[model samples]
Target: MPADLIFHHYANSPFSEKIRLIFGYKQLAWKSVIVPNILPKPDVLALTGGYRKTPVLQIGADVYCDTALICDVLEHLRPEPTLYPPHLKGVCRIFAQWADNTLFWAAMGYNFQPKGAAQVFAHAPPDAAKLFAEDRKSMMAQLVRLRPGDATSAYRSYLRRIANMVDEHDYLFGAQPCVADFAACHSIWFTQTQVPVMADILNATPSVGEWLQRMMSLGHGTMAQFDSAGAIAAAKAAEPQPPGANYLVDSAFQDDHGIPLGARVAVGGESFGPEPTEGTLIAATRTHYTLLREDDRTGAVHVHFPRLGYTLRKVEAG
Candidate 1:
């Protein structure tokens, strides 16, 4: 039987939209659990230890933190619509990473300018914008954020580059959409769907806009409403898949940090959203880290973080 995919995310979250679109392209059936846009994400913390990034994917007792890993897991589960197509495999991943980080931040910096911010928070409570700003500030204090004007310039150039690619092909790559397309489209999706007031930035590259429509048409796959309570229950009742249960298991532990498999460790993103998820390191594969963390509400759930953008630290014996 296929494991139930429980997705925790808010509707307006751009990162979440990327995963949702991938779900559509792959024709996945998943359970949706809406999470708060702001912090005090009690439900999220209970499952992930402390990593509170949007759009956490939970399958049974396994919680995948980042979208990159989530995409890999989904690909492993359902390989038909392969995320990393062979011809475009290496380039697709590199492009996806750039789009997810550089393009995403640049688009966001442009999207959340004063006018865009006002429009984005217009429907929310008066203090929503301020709170959201402050919250993001605290979470990303160590990282250098783009300035609105600078971001606008960068975003425009990126759009033109994207247009060049899509002008020749339907997607970022060829006819079929790859992970790069999903990664690139989310911020543009945000601009069009959530902050149309600022979407004019997309006009310079009409081809990109055309590409966006094509990507949007994929639509989120089959979905059912689920509550965080039910998700917690599912985690509690299920045991984590054995180490390397799927091909996700690496042949041998690759130890650059000198941290053993059984050691207590904290895994977190390298820059943005550095909040660590502390637990016993059950698996430290070349591509990811698996943390076995226990909670009163959720029992033991394996929290996985991709190695590319994340850091791992062993907790010294106390």
Candidate 2:
């Protein structure tokens, strides 16, 4: 059976935009379920247990959280348009990691300042913008956010570096687009496409603008809109599948958090978005971990999160 692919995301989400581009690049038919920009994502919470990040990919009973993991799932389903090429795999992975972490956040911090923030929230209600700001503030917690001036500087520098990369070749890695290109382009795309008033930073690097045009050409292919309600119903109707037995990364004892398997825990991503996901640790592999939990709406869905940014803590077992 061809596994069902459901994308739980909103349009304004830059990370979600990255996956949408991937879906279009691969020409994969998927059900688009628009999720909320901020918290109280009950439907997404239903599928993910508690990993309330945007762009959760639902494949059968498996719920993949984070755009990084979603990329892996998409690659598994469609290998034709490979995001990570064999020769450029290492460099692509490094560049992608840098782009997703550093570039993406800097761009967002800069793009969501007063000027760009107004452009984004122009259509949204006053309360809507306030709620979004409050929600993001809660998620950020102790993390230090860059000042608008600093953020703008960092973003401009990052854009120049990206332009330098494109100056050598058509894409970040080479002639064809790679994971790094998509990851980097999406953030820049958000500034240029979503918040054009603040897009003047791209003027210093016209090469980045030309590159973005090419990226835009790879349009988000035919996505039939699917309701979040229907997606929750689909997940509710299904049975949870066994977790993948194979380990995807190297297992090294990095942290002192000696949490055992099957222990109830809450894992929160360090920066950007710090929402905590609570569940039973089903699989603590080398790279990622799988959590099994019951949701009132969706019954059960195995949610996955990358180990890098997330901090795992033991929750009181009932």
Backbone N/Cα/C clashes per model: 0, 0
The runs of at least 3 residues in candidate 2 whose Cα sits more than 4 Å from the true structure, single-residue gaps closed, are 245-257
Q: Over all chains combined, what TM-score does candidate 2 have?
A: 0.93
Q: List TM-scores for all candidates, in order.
A: 0.98, 0.93
Clashing residue pairs in candidate 2 are none
Kindly report which residue stretches of model 1 are placed more than 4 angstroms away from their true locations once superposed: 246-251
lDDT of candidate 1 vs native? 0.91
Which candidate number has the best TM-score? 1
Error of 2 at 174 (Å): 0.4
Give the per-residue lDDT digits (tens) of candidate 2, residues 20-91. 899888888888998898888877877776667787888767787787777776776677789989999888
lDDT of 1 by residue, 1-318 (tens): 357999999999999999999889889999999999889899999999999989899999989989999999888888888899999899999999999999999999999998889889999998999899888987797788899999999999999999999999999889999999999999999998889999988878899989999999999999999999999999999998877884365636788999888899998878899988899998887798999989999998889888899999988878
Candidate 1: which pairs clash?
A: none
User: Which 10 successive residues of model 2 have the least lDDT summed?
Assistant: 245-254
TM-score of 1: 0.98
